[model samples]
Target: MKLFRQVFLSIAAMLAVQGASAADARLPVVASFSILGDIVANIGGDRIVVTTLVGPDQDAHVFQPAPDHIKSVARARLVVVNGLGFEGWMERVTQSANYRGDIVVASQGIAVRDRVEEEHDHDSHDGHDHHHGKNDPHAWQNPANIVIYTQNIVAALSKLDPAGAALYRKNGDAYIASLNELDRWAIQQFAQFPPAKRKVITSHDAFEYFGAHYQVRFLAPQGVSTESEPSAKEVAGLIRQIRKEKIRAVFIENMSSPKLLQQISKEAGVTLGGKLYADALSQADGPAPTYLKLMRYNIGQLLAQMKLN
Candidate 1:
């Protein structure tokens, strides 16, 4: 009985050591927001563990990092950001955390779109401070751009974890395939609607890439950044434009305040369309939990409303 007990104890100790070693093998990665978190998770699979500073349904525009976020960055082996001046606080957070890891700019290789200053400047009144950068940061709206994002992520992950390079590339290729399919479907869906009926209004200008790619036009009261609040004059002007164009596809973003859009819809004599996932993803139980589902849901909502237009 004593010999049997000793053998069992030795076996248990070996198993515990193996388990801890396996746990230690997982690379710690941090992403700026939930959308990127999901993408990184897909690429990393079981090889890396990911933490997101900005969670689902939270706006990254005005995200204030807490102590936990600082700790997350400090411990991360790799950090990823959208990098079109999207997360203005990211530099501050990384500085505070004193993170020394490699930082990956997910949108690094994509063709950037400059924010049309004249269009926004005309709408914004005096004393209105525009907070967004010169270029639009919502590149994930275009799946083609996400292809670039996926490639960057794969390259970053593989560099950090040479052993998992094959797996990361495999996952990235599969994701890019899905993105291509999504792009094709989006093109077909938008092609069914006439150009005149393709205009839409939302809480913010987060869909310019989507608009440009799919030939749909999106007008918003607020600028690219949700932090930029429109003046009464700007809101009135948008209301007038909505009326002039007879645009009925007015929608609110998941991460933005609906007060402005609600007011616009009521004053414009048009019913408010359903919520659209713009900068952030919805909760796991919601319609846009995944990146793929988010685009599909937004497209469905837009089409349903554009049919009325």
Candidate 2:
């Protein structure tokens, strides 16, 4: 009996050591939001464990980080952010956590679009600078920009985890290929319609990159950030544009309030088309759970509504 007990104890100890080693092997990473988290997970694969500060279907513009987020950041070896002034609260969170790690800006090398330019192009006549002349942080709306994001992530991951450099490169290349394919698909899809029929309206001005990439005109009542509400004049101007343009494709963003869009649709005499995943992604059980899925789902929604227009 003593010999059998000793053999079992040795096996258990070996199993525990193996489990701990496996756990220790994975590098801990913290992403600013769900969309970025999904992208990091695709590139990092099983080599890293990711914790997202803003979860799926949540608005990052009004996000309030808690103690758990600080703890996650503190434990992470690397922190990833979208970094076009997207996460206004990120600085405070990182400082409070005392995180001493590499911070990766995923949108680092992309061609940035200015909010003022977007406002002018979209025919926003509100005369209000919603973003205060800041750059649009929704670069991920364009698949081409996400290619840059993927490359940046790969470089950051490779630099931190030298042992996993080859794996990161391989994964990043695959993701970039997928992104290219998605962009090509989008171009072809949008090309089928005339430029006049490529106009859409959503709750917020989050699709400027997307609009520029596919040559679609996206009109919105609110500005880049969901925190910025549209004034009465701004809302009236958008309603007039919708009526004048005969635009029937109206959508509500998954992360934004539907009330404003509902009111716009009612005043403009257009039915609410559907929900588009803009700043954040949907839950795992819903349509968009991953970055790729989010893009595809949003494209599908826009196309369906644009068909009516």
Candidate 3:
């Protein structure tokens, strides 16, 4: 009985040591939002543990980080964020959290376009201020932009965990290939539409990058951020423009308020084009759970809605 008890204790010690070592092997990362979290997970695979701040179907535009978010940041090995003023609150939160981790701006290499704010220049916004002259932060809306984001993620992860460099590279390369495939597919689908009919209306200006890349023109009542509301004059002008241009599809974004857009659709007398996953993605069982799925779902919605005469 004594010998058997000794063996059981030895086995338990060995298992505990193994668990500790396994825990130490993982690089803990904190992503400012869900989309970035998903991309990090794709590259990190099983080598890293990622904590997302803003979850799926959540808006990062007006996100107020909780007290726990500070603790998450402080404990992270790396912090990933979609820069370009997208997460205006992130810097302040990280500073307060005293996060001493390597910060990676995923949208580093992409050429940021100026957000057009003429529509909301005079409107009273509720929580946050989203002015148009600022740089648009929704680069992930474009797959080409995501190529840069993935490269940044892989580089950041490799720098943090040198032993997992090969895995990160392989995973990043595979994701880029998939992104390229989606790009080609989108190009072909958009090719079938005439320039005039390819116009779209989304809740906010998040899809500007998508429009720029795919040759579709997107009009929005709100600015880049969902915090801003369009004035009555802007709505009237948009209604007139839609009537004049014969625009077909108007979409509601997952992150923005549907009330305003719904009103716009009713006033404009156009069918509400299905919901587009803009700033954030859907739940796991929904159409857009991953970054790839988000883009495909948005594209599918655009194609289906634009096809309506």
Candidate 4:
């Protein structure tokens, strides 16, 4: 009878533990787009259900939220964003929907890069500059900026779920370490091309951070957002620049249609280096699923096709 009672107590304790574990499950989350989704997944893991407002292959720069998107946001306990004016419509939509959840600005305290007209020569993407805030919103293009993202995520998640604080910190640390290693690799790979050959033109000015960090010169036909289709005159002007500068490659941005870029490539007589992930992360099965992987894949392809003869 004593042995049986001990066994019964052990079984009861195990059941109690399981019940408590289920009760402690975390809240539902919603990320503005793919990159945020990836970062949240890296930390949220199995603790929370995460839904992306704009997923991979979708253009967040021009994402018009649907009824389902609003429903998801309303149901979310937390919403992560890349703040700095990247998603202009986010604030209004969330406010309109009365979302009272934690809105985490992933790039909260990171040092912003200069994006004034004088800073860059190309006047192609002018008049559309949304450089109102402290820094450029394309912080994800520079891996160093990701440190701020990870930390902000850790703090936000901890505030929302104190019990999972340690787990969130651990995941952020691991992911940041991986991003640091990627920074080194980017420097090395980008070094392969001589300074003169480091120039490439694209459909949009989404690569300012990438160019600034890797010493590459990026000329965008359109403005910052992919939604801004350049006028025919602008395309002709870019074609002239490509011919005069003998630019190595014209890259197609993942978020934008390749049709416009193809036209530029054909007119300029330059090769389309590769597709660059300008605004969002790649699909789970694609090459640029994670932020780090996206950077490496983009830089590698650029180098391979843009290397000077």
* Best-matching candidate per lDDT: 1
lDDT of 4 by residue, 44-85 (tens): 776777888899878887789888888888888899999988
Better of 2 and 4 by TM-score: 2
TM-score of each: 0.92, 0.93, 0.91, 0.85
Instruction: Kindly indicate the candidate among 1 and 3 with the higher lDDT.
Output: 1
Candidate rank order under TM-score: 2, 1, 3, 4
lDDT by residue for model 1 (46-103), tens: 9988999999999999998999999999999999999999999999999999989999
How many clashes show up per model? 0, 0, 0, 0
In model 4, which runs have C-alpha deviations exceeding 4 angstroms? Answer: 1-24, 117-135
lDDT of 2: 0.90
lDDT of 3 at 8: 100
Q: Please, what's the RMSD in Å of model 4? A: 5.0
Of 1 and 3, the candidate ranking higher by TM-score? 1
lDDT of each: 0.91, 0.90, 0.88, 0.81
